[model samples]
Each structure stands twice: as structure tokens, then as C-alpha cells.
Target chain A: MIEVAGGRLIAELTVRRPSFTLDVSLEVAAGELVAVLGPNGSGKSTLLGALAGLLRPDTGRIELDGRVLTDTTAGVHVPAHRRRVSLLAQQALLFPHLSVAANVAFGPRCAGVGRAAANEQARGWLAEVDALELARRRPGQLSGGQAQRVALARALAGEPELLLLDEPLASLDIDVAPAMRSLLRRVLRGDRGGGDRGGNAVGARTALLVTHHLLDAVVLANRVVVLAEGRVVEDGPAREVLTRPRSPFAARIAGLNLIPGTGCAEGLRTHDGTLVSGLLDAGVSGLLDAGESDSWDGAPAVAVFAPSAVSVFRQRPDGSPRNVFAVRLAALEPHAEVVRLRVSAPPGGPDWLDGLAADISPAAVADLGIGDALGDVLWFAVKATEVLAHPSVH
Target chain B: MVGVGLPVVLWAPAVLGFALVALPVVGLVLRADLVRLPELMTSEEALTALKLSLFTAAVSTLLTALLGGPLAAVLARSRSAAVRLARPVVLLPLVLPPVVGGLALLYTLGRTGPGGRLLELWFGVTVPFTTAAVVLAQTFVSMPFLVVSLEGALRTAGERYERVAATLGAAPATVFRRVTLPLVLPGLGSGLVLAFARSLGEFGATVAFAGSLEGTTRTLPLLVYQQREVDTDGAIALSLVLVVVAVVVVAVARPRVAEGAQ
Candidate 1:
């Protein structure tokens, strides 16, 4: 039996649909803002649905703050309203017919709070979100950011055990995101609340934010769980994962190149059996802390580094770097300030090392005489200090 | 707009149909005994029928809303095949001839039908030829209007807001009361007015199922029909009252601005 943590949420859920199957397991510790990051159709919304009780999982268990919200095995299920969870979606979803004050008061009112007390609580939350002035206004009249502020206030007024935010900032204007981001940071950090903000009777005011924007995680979340195709692909401390991603999708979002392999004391041998003999940076070297006996046991690992770390050479001109691979240009496309060359893997590579992309200047392309639809064989190398090798995430 | 001047013969029938609808109302107004309208309407028969009509129609509208609300909500939210089939089936009375609807109501609640026989045998209640029968006939035909209108509004409003409310700690009943009801108020209002008007003008059903009894089941429409044969002046005078009700119905039910474009 798993011991439950107070103010903690643990879910091992498998929700089945005709077109989608979301199977994931995770734990959110007390006061932790965990961002469920994923691209579209990645089951980010589905996970929120299951947690919020809008959609029931076929077989699983979900426990929040040591209380079971759902347990299919035991046939125990709580309704959404009774679970004390609050959800804020991309749209503010403020009740259009209700005034902003009434909208925020709705949750408390439903919880059997007296109307006056509920309105006062609503006012308090609105003030916390800096939306007190909009209390009399209808949702249709409010701007995008203001509506979202009211929505946040409404969700907070519930004193929810778990707060689910699904792309809360996704629909805001570009000019509004920065301010909203900082406001959310303040609220999630418990800065404006009483001394025991997330520690009152309802346990912690824990939150799960589903977002595609990495910046939201960087600014608002303390932990990040990356989802791809409905699976928990990676989970780590927010800054840790953002700065040193170990999974391919996370690496892509972090704008780094990742090569999956098995780590040895020397370095990483990629899936193609090509020895990527790079000196382990401190971050990558952490995975190699084990002795030779443990190291050779063959747990998969990934070597991640920035595109700029790999230098292209006309001929094999690498004297210092041991990792040298011949590559042929597959295609060239424009990146922000540089042209990215998508190339086939090193010559003599196994079928597993499919391809990689490297950023180069237009001047560099011209200097190398790279042509449109170029098929010329080139060589690329990376110094040992650049690669961060870690145990594979997936 | 249709093509300008294709053929006169093709469009003549539509114009003639429009005229046919307009001429009767125009003739009624033209021949209205306006000067003695107050005196004619205050007569014993006219007053009884007017009061009975108002009472039955109001009661029928209330009953329609009370009974139809849950049915509309179910039809709006459920994806089951029976509900899908039954939604339009519930509106049969709306498209049905009122005389036919009245006959159906008569057989179901008359002395011989199983429900009617059981009611009389168990409770000593005879439903037909009574005020209750008038209310029932009006409800049988007009309830469909309320249901269909409310069902459309409920479907348009959708369950997203209700789901959000539920997650916000509001119980299902609370969500319906505070969220769903208020959101569908406009549709409910229109449905009520339409049902009221249908009940008011429910001549065929009232006469056939409830019978034409003065001060009991004979409503305004039945009074006007009786007056039309024996007293033209009284019929026109009573018609003016109906026209007033129709005007009020239009004023109350007409949608303003048509849509929430913003």
C-alpha cells in the first residue's frame, strides 16, 4: 500500500476514449505548482478532465490530500462538486449572465456559504487578483486579461483542494501575458494569503497547470511534467528540466539536440554504437557517478547539447574532438537569426541514428559553398565539454 | 431576394395566400363594434368565457413549463437514441391539427379510456366536460411549444458552463438553478408566451375534448365561435379582445436585436 502524503496528489489513471487513451501516473507534492506541458492532442486536457472529475477513468485511482477522489477498483467515486477541486480553462468562462462579483461568489455560495459572506470572500479574491473594479461588469464587457483575472478569483474563492488551470494564459493577448504571468506567480507562491495559505483545513491549494508555453513553467511552476502522446515522458524540477532536458520532446522544447544511448565510464555510446566520446559536463556526469560495475549494466541514457556546440568542417579538420561524424545535407531551412541545416546522421551510422539539425550562418553556408538541395558529404564534430549526458527519461 | 420578374403565374399563388391570410383580420377590424366594445365584453357570457380562458391558459402555461422543463433538459443533455427520437415526437401536437389532438386527448382521458376509467373508478373523478378538461386539452396541444423552445435554448447553452460550475463546488441541482435556468431564461420566456397564446386560442381541442359548456369549459375562442353564428356584433367585439391578446403575445415573444453579435 502506498502511504498518502497530506496536501499531496497522486494519480495513476487510465482513461479510455474511442480516439484517445490517456494513461499516466504522477504525484504533486504540497504547494507544488506542477505544469503538465505537452503539445496539442498530447492528453494534457484529458488529464485535467480526469482530475477534475468531468471525465471518469476506466481503471485507476486518484487521491488528493489523502482523500480518495476516485478509485475504480473499489467503486468509490466522488462527484466533481464534492471533490473540492476548481478548474480554470483557457477561456475565462465567467458566467455571462452573472455580474463579476456574483460569478466569483458562485463557488462559495454553492459550498453553502452565506450570500453576504460569499460576496465578501468573492470581493477579497477579486481584490487579490486586482479585479475588484470589474465586479459589477458582465463577462462580455471585460477585456481578455480582466476576464481571466475574474476567473482566477472565482476558482480561488472555492478554497479548492486542487486547482486545475488548463492553458489559463493561452488565450490572453501578447501584451497581457507578462503581467498575468507575474500575477499568477504571486498567487501560486502564496504571497498574498494568510500565514498558512495552502495549509488550512483544505490541505494545500495545490495546482496543476496544463500549458504548451515553456515560459509558464519557468515563471509559475516549481515542477514540470512533460507529456507526449498521453504518457509521462519526463518529470523533474522545473529549472532542472528546462535547462537540461533528457527527453527528445523536452529537448526540442528546450531547443537542444538529444541523442539516446547507453552511458559508460568513458562517455555515451549512442544507439547506433557510435562512441560519442565527449567529456561529461557536470550535469551529464551526474548519471555516471556509479562505479564500472553499475555503469556497464546498460540503463539507457541521452546526450544533450546545443546546436552551436557541433561545428561543421569541410574536411575532417577536428584535431581535439574525438566525436566526429560525416553527414550529408538533407535540407536547409531558416531559423531566427541563422539557417538550420537538417542533415542525415554520420556516415556508417546504424539505422537508429536517423538525422539531426545544426544552425549555421548564411555567411557560413556561403563560405562552405552549400547549395540548394545540396547532397555533398560534410563532417561535423563536437568537443567533449559540450554534451550533457544523463539517464534517458522515457 | 428572389429573381426579379421571372413569371407572374409562378408567384401569384403566394401573393394570393398572403392576401387570404390578411383579408380576414382586416375585415374583422373594419367591422369591429368599437363604440360598444366595453359593454359587449362586460356581458355575462363574454365575461365568463374571458375569465375562464385566462384562467385555463395561465394554468396550462404553468403546467407546461413545470412538466416540460425536465423533459427539455433531458433531451438537451442526453445522447441516448430514445431521447433523440422522442424530442421531435413530443412536438407532434405542434404540427398536428388541433381537432385531431383534441380527439386524441378525449380518448385518453374520456370515460372509456383505461386511464379515465381507472380515475373514475378509483377517485370518482370524471375528467371530460369540466374545467380540468379544458386545462388538459390546452396543455396537450400547447405543452409541445414550451418543450421545443426550451430544448433549443438548453442545447445552445451547452454543458460547458454547468461542468465548470460543478467543478467549482456547486452541486448538480445548484448548477441547474443558478446556471442553467438563468442562462435559458429568454427561451423559457418565449416558450411561456407561445404556450399561453396557443392555450388561449385552443377552440377545437377545448370544444371537442372538454365540451362547450358556458362558465366552465367554454373559453373565449368557443364564445367567439358561438357568437359568430347568432350575434355578429358580439363576435366582432369579442374578436377585438383576442386581437389584443395576440398583440400582447407578439410584443412579449418577439426577439430583440435577434442575436448577441458581439
Candidate 2:
């Protein structure tokens, strides 16, 4: 049962809603914080609800640390309160009527701890979250950030075995989110708080953080699991998944232009048979060189490049870049100091390669005189050296 | 902001509406004999009615809160068709004539009624024309106020905080006691006040169900009605007393602000 030192969760479930269905299989090792990244309505919160026992999946099994929380076939189910899982939502949602100290003590009090001991434990958790000074304040009196801090203390006061964070920083001010993020990172890693509590060994508790923000995944999660269309499309270490995303949603979050195709000797060939010539990423090259039995001739692969690497021209240039395509301007958006042009394949060109973003300097947009040329055929070029082609996971 | 400006013609009807409510009280005050006001108000019948009104109103308010609170909670959360259908029935007393409400209760618990017959056969209990009947009548008529106020409060306050509490290891009952109850306290406060005011002013229901027995069942409104036949001066003084009590209840509760605050 103790496959690893920490609590390990294995969930494979299908939840059907009116307009959408979520089917996902996921695993998170004990003490590991895995960020679930997806767009809205992509089943991110549904996954959290299933894990916290607030939702009952249509059919599946969810086992955490060898204890089955839900099993449709076995007719086993655990209610949310007894599941020993806590959730910190976008809003602080602190009990407005209770003092901050009492709010934090509420979990312990509900668990049948005596008043004095619960208060003492609450203070300890509050200090761990650096919110001890707010003990006497009511939830309504605190700022958004302070309230979130107290909410975190209250969530931890119960010593939950699993902590589900549903975009805890989403409601915070932009300027205050970074500080909270660092605090979350520290506490989730077990750098603070008493480590000797039951089911909460001397390290971080198992956590599944649902977020759409890439920064949250990069900063606080050990691994990133990307969801698209209610399925796990990408799951790997945070850095690897963010850098070489196979799903369009993941690529968008990572701020990269991704072209999906099949790998060949020269480069990747799109479904329309247009060869996007590029150099294989070092990881893919290493995998091929390791002498795996399967050949890479027609395996699924993706070519990714920074949007800044794309060069746009009104007319075909003389050099003829290896990755040049006849494209049409889709939309122009202001991205910081540059104007990002969203280009797509021209009328006669392959339609699969669409919505490719090219970020160019504002001066370049003026020099090229293409600022108002929406839907006009243009040339988008990227050097083979700039593109990193890797094997697609799905 | 432009269209929100009040038109000149609108103020006339609005002022007339205000005057309609204010003029009656002014007439009552003008007709009262100020020198004998204290004497008329302190009569034995008036004092008994006032005491009975306060006691019955207090007890009925407690009973309504105990039963209506859970009813409101269930109404707010339940999606079943039965609950949806029952919602209007729960609110029927609000729109139904108070006399009709009293008749419904009497028929349901009267000596010849099914529940009354069962109570008599099992425990030999008679529920009409007693002080307890006054309380029962008050609770029946006043329940809709508390239920409506609390249901709106529960809906406005939402289940998010309760869901959060459940995840934080609070059982369903604890979540209700600690989080749900406190979140809607302002709603509960105004509901209880409205119920108390309704109970205090109860007349028609008590007349039909409890029969205006002085000291035992006759409340303030019933006493004022009884006095109006033989002692018009005492009735007017007691009517003023009822008006004062209602005003105090409203002032203490601050219904508009407290109910809308959530």
C-alpha cells in the first residue's frame, strides 16, 4: 500500500454533465503538488470536486493512500467531511461571523478537539502562515490577501491528508499574488508547520492545484498536467511540459507557437502534407539515438517555436527560409511593446497551420505597412534553427 | 443615471401613498384624550391583553423560528419537485386571510378533525380556545414571514461557504450550526422580528381559533376589537399601543438594511 513515502492518489473516472463529459485518469504521489492546468469548463474543477468527494463520478474508483474514497462498482463512498481533504477556493470564503482565530479553530473544533487546545493549535497554524497578528480580526475586516492567508491557516488547521487548491490566487490582486504564491510554495513543501501530525508526515501534504495560470504551475507545482476537452493531453515535469507542450491549450499558456504533425527524416509533415522543416529537439534526438525499436519516420510529433522567432513579410523574401508559408493576417493584438500578428495559411495554402502568432516590433509593422492589411496574403518565415521539433505525447 | 431622475408627476402619488399610512395614526392620536390616556391604557383588560400578546408573540416567534428555519434551508437547497410544489403552500399563510388561516388550523386540530381526534384518543388533549391555541394560531399565521425572509437570505448567502466548511472537515450538521447559520444571521434576525410583529398584531386568527378569552387567549388586537364595542376610548388607546410596538419592532430590526445586507 505504501508504494511511496507519501500519500498516492489514483483516480480514473468519468463524470457526465449535460453538455460536457469529463473522462480522466490521473495519479499524484504523496507530498507532490501537481498543477492541473486547463481552460474554463475543461473539467479542472470537476476533477477537484471528485477528489474532495463533493462530486460522484458516473463510474470509476478513487483511492488515496490505499483508502478508497469512491468506488461505483463496489458501492463504497466517503462523504466530503470524512474524506480528510480540504479545498481552498478562489475566494477566501472565511466565515464572516467568526473571528479569524475562531475561523481557524473551527476545523479543529468540528473534529471534536477541546476549545482551548483547538485555539492553541489554530494559533500555531496561523503563525506558520504568517497570519498570527490577524487572529482577533474578523474575516470582513481583513484585506483580500490577509483573508486568504487566514483561510489557508484554517484549511491547514484540520491537518488534512490532501489539500485541493482551486485557483487560490485567482481572486487576489495582481500585486499580492506573488507573495501568496511563495507562501503556498513554502507551506506546500513542508518548510513550515509542525511535521509530526497524523497522516501529515514531516513533509508536504499531497496537493492537486487546479489553475489556468502558467506561472502557478511553474512556481508551485512539481509536475504539470494539462487538460483539454476533459482529457489529460500532457503530463510531465513542469519545465518539460511547459516548454514542449503537445496540446494547443498548453502551448498557448506557455506562449509558444505549436504545429502538430508527423515526424519525418527532414522535419514534421502537417496533415495537409506541408513539410515544416526543423531540427529535432535534443530530447527527441536522444530518444531516437537510444535505439528504441520503433522508427521515428511517421510518429506523431510537434514543432514549437517562440512567437518572437517568426518574421513577417508583405511579399516573399529572397532568402527563402526553410519554414516559410503563404499566410493571411487573422488579427493584430498589442503585446507589450510589440504588435502580435495572428496569421493563418492563405486561401490556397494548407488550412491546418492556422492561428500562428508572430510578434514583431511596432516599428516593423509600420515599416512593412501591414497594420491594416487584415485577411491579406502575407509571408511568415521561421528559421529551422529557431524551431524545436519534439515527439508529441498524444 | 439620466433616466433615474424622478419625474415631477411621480411625487404626487408617492406622497399620497405616504399620507395614506400616516393619516390614520395621526387621526388616532388626535382623537385620544391625552389626560385620560394613561388611565385607559392601564385598565385591567388592556394590561391582560398586552401581557398575553407579549407572551404569545414571544412563544410563537420561537416556535416559528425553530420550524421555519429548517423549512427555509430545505427550500433553498432542495431541487425535488415536491419541495418546489410545497414552497407555495408554505407561503400560503402570507397571502391567505388571517381568519382563513385560523379556520384551517382549527379544522385540522379541532375536536372533530382527524389530528384532533387522534390526539384526543391517544392523549386526551384539546387544543382550542386555550392560551396554547393562541400561540398555535400566531405561529401558523406568522410562519410565512420568517420562512420567506430566511429563504431569501439562504439563497443570497449561497452554499459556497457551507461547501468550504464541509471540505474543512465539518459534518453537515456542524456546517449548518457554524457556517450556514452565521452566514444568514441577518436574515434570521429580520425574519424573527417580522414574525414577532405579526404575532403581536394577530387578531383575526385568534378570534376564530382561540375565541378571545381574556387572560387566556385574547391578544392585543383581539382586546382592542372587544373594547371597540363598549369602550371606544380604551380601544383607540390600545390600538395606539399596538402601533407603537410594531414601530419599535421595525426600528429594532432595521429590516431593509439587515435583510438586504446579505
Candidate 3:
């Protein structure tokens, strides 16, 4: 863990609305981009509002770069405009009356910078974002993708100490999203040609991104924090959290199947007292890292595997696979190059396998004829070698 | 709905509505003394009434913008109970008879009224039967147009952009000036035009509160009313002029007024 004393942004607060309450404690190191992922109504926006100083937390403090932005105990609530933090929302929302250049220069001009210097800075930032040609155009003239590019330039031209991004690329077209993503990667990585001037080297900035797309986390963020029902359920490095998610929400986002159980000698025992054997996850250092023994007897554990690992059959498969369950074919969805079958536990069977998915090729699906067998009981089997069981902290 | 044609049954009432609004102006144009129009419209009394109407409408529209602009902004952004209650009250003049509005103004600012007595006793000022009273009466009746238009514009514009500006380090005042005002500029323009047109057509309030006096308070509408008894042809000519100006103002403001409605 990075030193909390050296953290660039520290937010530990609780916000209460009429029907919901958000309690989150997050610390972002300098120059780090952390992606926040959650389902809807998970307080993702509330967290962003608090960080942006748009909503005051009912309790706790928000400290950024040693400045106390909000401290309920001390009664110090710095307003949003004075906080030097910028937010880029899903909509570009560029000023309709101002030219693209003026929109970008709005922040600098508000900060009392000279008009000419602010325009120069805007042009520089626009060029960095590869949108210099759009300087004279009005916002109405720009396409969705172009507008988002200008929005990024405007957000960066402010030289914010911390930037909050609320699904900035979610509204773009599928074809345009990748280009916007690449532009964000370039500007965020701060590897552009220009030398560091005006203290906007870009690499020195901290950012918190909220998104629902897994690709955004894998491509843009160094770390991932998952919230569920207004609580942080999983927080780790992006790859680790995505690959070995302990929370069901994170697993769903990562498109992996997760089974909650207690650790045993081989794999784990479900709540129904069924023993499911699997190999210990080699990626998890120490296997049981919390000073626990390798036995892992009765410890909280989870078995994670890809949807492709499970094989479906109409009749009971006579195989050497160590794990098998009787499941009902719940639903079939067409994934790219494959047909995904959502299976639930059959009557008088362990319920832990409900909602687990199995991905089979289209040809295999045709051969199995499961498309005509919805709600019929089928056998789902996974080899012990395919399952990776590891200690679950929560 | 985008490419569909209107129902055949709907065209009758639509045309009837159009005729209802358009036939009166057509009648006035037909009744005007075309050969003597130039002479009658350019008469001394007609010219003075036109000048006074234009001047008072201009001042009152300015006053509406200066005062009504901020009031609309506050009404759009504020959620206080008092503001919520005051909203319909502020728009009362839009529905209230202009004569009643003039009476209310008279009771508040007339020589025998409390505010008028205060002004006379302390400041030695009398407001009734003056050019200032004409401007005030015009402002009082026309203010609701500007306020309702601007408030709709502000609400339709929403606070999302304002929030974006604030996060970009713009102070509250700067956000209002730079982001909010420019965003609602079209609405403000339409509101001002509407207010100006309403002020130009003001008659009842001016007659009741300012007491129509030639060269001082008698505006175009009042002059038309006055000349109807003495010179019917002159009244018809001046009435045609008022209708032409109203048409021009409404035409200029129609597009932006539609935008604010959205």
C-alpha cells in the first residue's frame, strides 16, 4: 500500500440522502488513475459529487494535496470553484455561445489569466489533444467524438490537481469510442511531444474515473475499486481484481464466474455441504496470505473460473471431471463467436450453481440442441484443473 | 409523428383560429384612410403619442431587463417556499386586467396612497400623472412577460452547464455572467422584445395610473382611444400603425420564443 501521508487525495466521508447513504474512504496516490466500478444506485455519483465539492459530506473529511477541502469536524467546507478540481461528464456540454477556443480558455480566464495568454494556453492544450483544427468551430458544429475531445482539452486546460471523470466516453459511438479512449490514454499518460510547461505535464495529475465498462478499467486505470450498494466491496490492482474478484458485482463486471465457499483441503465446501475440488490459485501469493496455513481449513474462500470452462450435456456425462452439478438451462444469450447458456441449480440440488454461465461454440450449441431445451435439466461439469480457488478476504 | 400529416378534421379549427387572430388586423387595414394616412399618422398629436410610446416602452423594457432578469434567475434556481409562492403572484399581472394592475399601482404609488404619501412627505416627490408613472405602469404590466420568458429559458437551459463551470473554477458571479447569461441570451432577447411590444400596446394602466396627457402620457394606444370619438379615420390609421409594429415585433421574436418553450 502506498503511504497515506503521501497520498495526493484522501476522501473519507459519508453522505446521506433521503433514501440512501454513502460511506466511502478512498485514497489515491499522486499521478494515479483509479477506476470506480459499480452497478446503478451504488453511490458512484455521490462519491464523485463529494470529491468534486458539489455535495457536502455529512461527516468526515476530504483532503487534497494537504488542503482540507471539507472537514465536518473543523467546519471547513471549501466551495467547488475554489477547489481547483475539474469534472468531465458523459456529455461534452461545451458553451454554445463560445467558440471551441473560448470554451477551453474559460477556466484560465476565470482564474484571472490574461485573455491572450489564456487563448494561447487553450490552443496549446487543444493541439495536445489533437483538436487544434477545431479551435474556431462552435460546439454545435462538432460531432459527438470531436466534442468529447474538446471537452477533454477543456478539462485539462484548467490544470486541475485532481480530475473526476464520469463516464466521459460512454456516450460516444462504438466506432468512435476506441479513438476517444486512445486519446484519453495519450493525454492521461502524458507522453506527448511537448515538454512539461505551465505545470501541466499531465503525468503529475491525479484522476478518479467512474465507468461501467470493463475495457475502461483494463485499458485506462492502474487500480480498480468496486462498490456495491454504497460500500467498497473490492479494491485492488486492476488485473488482480478483475481476475480474482471476491465480490459478485466485480465478477459480473469482469465476466467471470465466482462461487463463494469455505476453503478445504482440495478446494472449497459450499453452504449445502457439497465438496467442490479445485486447484489452488497460483497467482495469489502465499495462497492464504493472511498468515493462514496452507491447509485453508474452514477459511472463507472463493472459486473463480471462466464461463468457457463449464461443459453442458443433456445426459449425465461419464467423465473424470471432479466437479458436476445438475442444472436447469435458464437462458441463452449470443456472445461473440459463442452461445452463452445461463444455468441454474435444478430442484433438490445445490443452489450455489444458479446464475453460473457456460460458453459453448455455436456449432457445439447446435449439436447439443439446448436451444430447444430451455428450462430442461442439464448436467454441467468442470474439471478440477479449470477452477482456481483462493482465500476471500470479505 | 415526424413525417406524418395532420388529420383532415383538424384543419378547420386551425384555419378558424388563424382567421380569428388575423381578421381584426385586416379589418383595421381596410378601414384606414389610405390617402390621408400619411397626414393623419404624421399629425402633431399622433407624432407626440408615438414618440412618448416608443420612449416609455424603451425605458420600461430596460427597467424590466435590469430588474426582471435577476428575478427570473432567482426564481429559476431557488427552491424556497416563499419563492414558490411568489412565482404565481409575480405573474399575476399577466392574467389580471391591466386596469386592475393600474389600480394596484395607484394604491401603492398614488399621491393619497401610502408609498406616494411617503415619497411626498420625505422626498417631496409626486409620481401620479407624470411621465415616470407611465413608465412604471408599463413596467408593471409588461414585467411578467419578460420574467416568464426568461425564467422558462433559464429552467430549460438547466444547471448542468453551470455546475460544469463551477467545477472549472468559476465563481458564482462569474458563472452567472459568463455561462448562465450567454446560454439564455436568445430567451432574454425574446423576453425583451415581448416586453417592449407589450409596453407599446399599454393603454389601460397608463390611462388609470398616469392619466393620459398629450405629449406626456398619451401613448399610441391612448391616442387611438382618444381619436376614436373625435376623428374616426385618424384612429383607424393609427390603429393600423400599432398593428403593423406588433406584427413586426412578434415576427422577430417568434423563433426564439419557440426555442424557450422547448
True contacts kept of 1: 0.92
Assess each model's interface with DockQ, reporting 2 decimals per model.
0.73, 0.78, 0.79
Model 2, span A79-172: residue lDDT tens? 9998888999999999888999999998999899999999999888888778889999988899999999999989888878788999999999
Question: Is candidate 1 or 3 superior in lDDT?
Answer: 3
DockQ ranking, high to low:
3, 2, 1
User: Which portions of model 3 miss their true places by more than 4 Å?
Assistant: A1-7, A192-200, A261-276, A279-301, A316-321, A344-354, A391-393, B258-262
**Which of the numbered candidates is closest to the native, going by highest DockQ?**
3
Residue A44 miss distance in model 1 (angstroms) = 1.5
Fnat by candidate, in order: 0.92, 0.90, 0.90
Runs with alpha carbons beyond 4 Å of true place in candidate 1: A1-6, A191-204, A259-300, A310-336, A339-356, A365-387, B1-24, B27-44, B79-82, B226-237, B256-262
Model 3 misses residue B245 by how many Å?
1.5
Cα lDDT tens digits, model 3, B1-262, are 4878779999999999999999988888888889999999899888899999999999999999999999999899998999999999999999999998899889999989999999999999999999999999999999999999899889889999999999999999999999999889999999999999999999888899999889988999999999899999999989988988898998999998787666
Superposed by TM-score, candidate 1 places the C-alpha of residue A303 at a distance from the truth, in angstroms, of 3.9
Classified by CAPRI criteria, candidate 1 counts as: medium
Quality of model 1 by C-alpha lDDT: 0.83
Candidate 2 backbone collisions, by pair:
none
Winner on lDDT (2 vs 3): 3
Q: What DockQ score does model 2 reach against the true complex?
A: 0.78
